[model samples]
Target: MTPRWTATGLSQDLPKGVVMAGHWQGHDLAVWRSATGRLQAWNDRCPHRGMRLSHGFVRGETLACIYHGWVYGAEGGCKHIPAHPALTPPATITVTAFACVEQDGVIWVAPADMAGSPPAVSGVQPLRSVSLTCDLAAVLAVEPALLGQDILRGTVQIDGQGHDVCLLVQNNPAGLTLHALCGVRANKVAASHWVENLRRRAEMKVAA
Candidate 1:
């Protein structure tokens, strides 16, 4: 099967030394950036005890599980086991990792064997992400101009001006999320308000 990249989050949102929960094609992911700025996406569950690795903390170049402080290093291999300090963790104790990359201020994830780079969105800046209680159809119903399946692109009226906007779609269990981006020269505050307004309108349509 061909590999597809899913926009998981914005690059600025997942700074170094932080971890966040992400999803891709129904699989929950623990996406993190090491202290040195290495990006990684792994199965949310720790191999040792099934603890959500998203809750784990980053220590330098490794991710340590919050449950038992088991440290996973490069390629998701278990490097250290806090309980048995002297014992070297076997390679079998490894977390499942996916292909994670940051491009055009967006974080994209796919299966580990994914090959190509993520789609590019030039001349735009990252806006805030908003979760709507409705699906993509509701969004399109509200803004008929937006087009595309994964990366919705179009111009939105902001402050009486037409501003190019991009909404990266993320399908959540609850509904969905739109990781927004606006024209680089657009008024950020006004663009943000437009995003919220779009969410309200789309969700209200769903409710109706």
Candidate 2:
């Protein structure tokens, strides 16, 4: 399959020093933000002992594996080994890292060798992210208009006014997760309610 920058979550959802598990295409990924507010993405597996990096903690500019406390730098190289604090980790001790970026209120991740930047969107702010127990096709089946490679645009009506909303979708094994963004003139409450309704409809389709 062709690789592209996939939206993972809203920028506000991932604060500094936070780590979470994510998936892109078919690969399990570890997504985290350093103390300095930079986004990092890895294969979610530590080089040593094969522990999951997503279960690890972020300290300063490095991520420490919870199993053995082996710390890896932003470049995915092991920087510190707690068991051997006095010994420098070998240069070969490293984990696979990917390209990560945050723009337009969304966190994007791509393959390590993928080129180009995340698709751009303007004039909208992220309201929230929600997970649906369905595939991307089912999500589009609900409204059809909300179909796009990166950001999907649709309308939500509130107080008799049609407001524009954006949906940034990320496909995973469990289902499809989306970040909801609202236009400056959009109704936040209505947009949120619309998301809930969409989830129910899409998931209902998946179940049937």
Candidate 3:
């Protein structure tokens, strides 16, 4: 449902000291982790010149624009301007920031009162993520929910016994990206192969 963790990004993808453009429940998003390993998400536009902040860089705990070198903090507050180093950027120069948190190795973005906290995926290990050109209905049609279709769904073992799955499906501008996870004790080899098969099956589902 509507939660604070709004389909942010694949955990392993966004590395330290880098800024990436992403989407959160259809909203254009910019996600970046500081040198200290803190993650932040905000509207992709820069306040000064409307530069795409994803085109910016993480220079420590702040994100700096490549065009004119305006820097912002995790709270989306403008912290510096290279051209005029003497000026303390006004509070008005800050970018719109959303509440973000990472859990089960997945990134999430939403408003402050972002409904409930991120769903727990205790003891489950995320496998990999895949995007489907079709909607969730199409995805379910082929792989019908083995348990249920509710949010924070518990999936069946992709490779069977002792192997349970955790799925995070969200809609995007184009389609859907399924952030998949498996039980911590699931067979890695079988899990890997199963994900491969899932791709094939999901692809066929979307195509038809």
| Index of the highest-TM-score prediction | 1
Clashes of 3: 1
Answer with 1 or 2, whichever has the higher lDDT.
1
Candidate 1 per-residue C-alpha lDDT over 142-187 given as tens digits, one digit per residue, 9 for 90 to 100:
9998999889999879999999999999888988888999999899
Candidate 3 least-lDDT 10 residues: 145-154
| Candidate 3 runs further than 4 Å off | 1-4, 147-162
Clashes of each: 0, 0, 1
Q: Write the per-residue lDDT of candidate 2 for residues 1-208, one digit (tens) a residue.
A: 8898988888888899999988787888889999998889999888888888999999999999999899999899999998898999899998999889889988888988888899887888888999987877777888776757656787756457877778888887878788888888877887788888889988998889
Weakest 10 consecutive residues of candidate 2 by summed lDDT: 150-159
Better of 1 and 3 by lDDT: 1
Query: TM-score for model 2?
Result: 0.93
Estimate TM-scores for all models.
0.96, 0.93, 0.85
**By lDDT, who's the top model here?**
1
Q: Which should have the higher TM-score, number 1 or number 3? A: 1
The reply for model 1, stretches above 4 Å from the true place, is: none
Q: lDDT for model 1, please.
A: 0.92
- For each candidate, the alpha-carbon lDDT, in order, equals 0.92, 0.86, 0.76
